[model samples]
Target: MPLGVVIRRQPGVTRWAKWVWRAVAVLPGAASADWQELRREGEAVEYHAATLPLTVYRSETEAYRIVLAAESPSVFVVLHPSEEASPDRPYVVHSVTVSAHEAQQALDSGEELVEPVPMPPPLYAWLADFVDRHHADETFMKRKRGPAVEMQSEDGKGDARIRQAADVYRSPASRRKGELH
Candidate 1:
């Protein structure tokens, strides 16, 4: 499905960051948009940054299931600082994904910003249908424990081979100091 990324730019509160760029929403099955200005209110402005393909894989239905199970199901928008970044628009839309793990991976990079935009109704329905068709619960197989070892009761007798003259409960470090081997 074609996904359109909508980025919002607003004046930053801190001096360190002059402008804040964040992904506010996504347009599903939207036509190709290239930095198209959508709305403006005072200093805040929203842009249709890019239109990218949102692919749903059969293998990743489980990840999608986890995404849908959330209280507020959302699509994660990945944004990265552009090379030609300016005071007005510094970040660019990188990608959009439903997989929480993938979003986490993007976040772990420490370079890209990940924003979770609420899943639109049509997109949610599409994802639900896809998951219903492809998703299958994986059966958990519990492994049995191996045969237990018969533990010997040799309390206070440190190493049966070594004979202690002074302290019976001498620490292993103290014993190592005296012994050459």
Candidate 2:
């Protein structure tokens, strides 16, 4: 089950203030709540969203591990367009996650204005359970290369007999030319 978190932000006052993102509150497991307007410009209404359900799956265990191992483990609250497709309420909560690196990358890439908040214990436990259920341990098998062949083919040219395209692709000259060998 996905639990919801209400993310709140206060509007910036100075000119440079708009560039910074701050989280006011994170209400966990909230069913529903009132919508607060974020900003207004020429009748364009943007609302601050409450209650974004943070979800995780077993398939994301590796990603969760990376997130948890980060120096600053945090939950990111992302904003997006509303579900009903209304011009008035242009923004809503898109997703929330514990991946601090992902959140920083999203900000750096200009994907969205994400708010990073500290993950509460309950929410962390919830995500841990999801990952535990969905995560699978994958085993890797070492691949053995074919037995060493005579460097010199039947012909004294020292070049491999061109039986397939891979021969040309794996040629030293081709490899030097930046082809994958």
Candidate 3:
């Protein structure tokens, strides 16, 4: 079945906090090797894969926006149905949240499994645009300083620039005694 995965913003989360949360959300659980494989692609370090088929969406009540069902509370696993299965039909499967250690244990015991969800058209487009907009371009990544210019001093050494200018430019009568006019 086709599953829609969503990560909703949590309450009292600042913009920076949201970014951190998103970063955490993308991290692969203890048992998932898919994330490691995905990281082998171009700039894969920035991409995080969902451990479970779980979709997270924000609730209207502003509580528990990050939701996923895993065997343990800390690890989430993706469940993929058979290719011939219709998405419209509901399938019987257990969805529960479990801990990271427990998830690792399951994987170690040879019970870890995953089903890759095909990227939806809209999501694929969105991800493409997002990467294009956010990824730093190589050309701009290199730092370059602009050329520096030398400034000319108005006065020579030991010359009072202000007084000299005033004396050179001011009328004789306007000049004060012992002072540069």
Judging by lDDT against the true structure, name the best candidate: 1
lDDT of 3 at 86: 46
TM-score of each: 0.77, 0.53, 0.20
C-alpha lDDT (0 to 100) for residue 120 of candidate 2:
71
Model 3's lDDT to the true fold? 0.32
At residue 177, candidate 1 shows an lDDT of: 45
Q: How would the candidate models be sorted by lDDT, starting from the highest?
A: 1, 2, 3
| Candidate 1 structure quality by residue, lDDT tens digits, 84-129 | 9676567777889999889889999899999999999999999999
Alpha-carbon local distance difference test for all models:
0.87, 0.58, 0.32
- After superposing candidate 1 on the true structure, give the runs of residues whose Cα lies further than 4 Å from its correct spot: 143-181
**Judged by TM-score, which candidate is best?**
1
lDDT of 2 at 110: 76
| lDDT tens digits, residue span 63-141, model 2 | 7867666675567877664568563343566677776555766778775768766767776676667667777878998
- lDDT, candidate 3, residue 114? 26
* Candidate 2 minimal-lDDT segment of 10 residues: 1-10
The TM-score of predicted model 2 comes to 0.53
User: In lDDT terms, how accurate is model 1?
Assistant: 0.87
